[model samples]
Target: MLVLAFASSVENAVQRQLGIAVSVEMLISAKTKVTSCMEYVLVWDMPIVQFGGGIYRRRHTRIFGDQGHASPTICAYSLTRNKE
Candidate 1:
């Protein structure tokens, strides 16, 4: 998980440096899939933040295991609010 976080940070930095335009919703969706190995999922209104001159958001939820084990998961969303 730490490695994935690091990679994500790096990717975000690279995207920012390249001035790429991305949606926060899309980022969250991507991150969730990349970080977890779940079959069924659901997401609701998430918070947003500003990073690298863009807006980012995150949502927290509980992931349930088929074997009755559950874990907490955080999904982060990011996007450029301005076009340059």
Candidate 2:
């Protein structure tokens, strides 16, 4: 996938610059429907390092509402491991 390729490139860059081992992964995350009125929801599990310590983790989710709404497609990437 293109996202995975990008993550790999990023990993290469990080290793080249900082000399730290980092791992990146991508996956489709299922999300629970909050209300019955909602429809066509897409979610992605995107984790990014917030701070420079121990691979800070965060989740990124993108939601698409009902019809006639402009839905945005999002790709998520996460760092599974970090060797500092």
Model 1, span 1-84: residue lDDT tens:
111121134334234322223233323464454664333233222233357876543433123212111222322221121223
Clashing pairs in 2: none
Top candidate on TM-score is: 2
lDDT (10s digit) by residue, model 2, range 1-84: 221212333234234322223355545446954434312323332333434555433433134322212213331212222222
Full-model lDDT for every candidate: 0.30, 0.31
In model 1, what is the error at residue 8, expressed in angstroms? 2.9
Task: For candidate 1, give the lDDT of residue 38.
Answer: 30
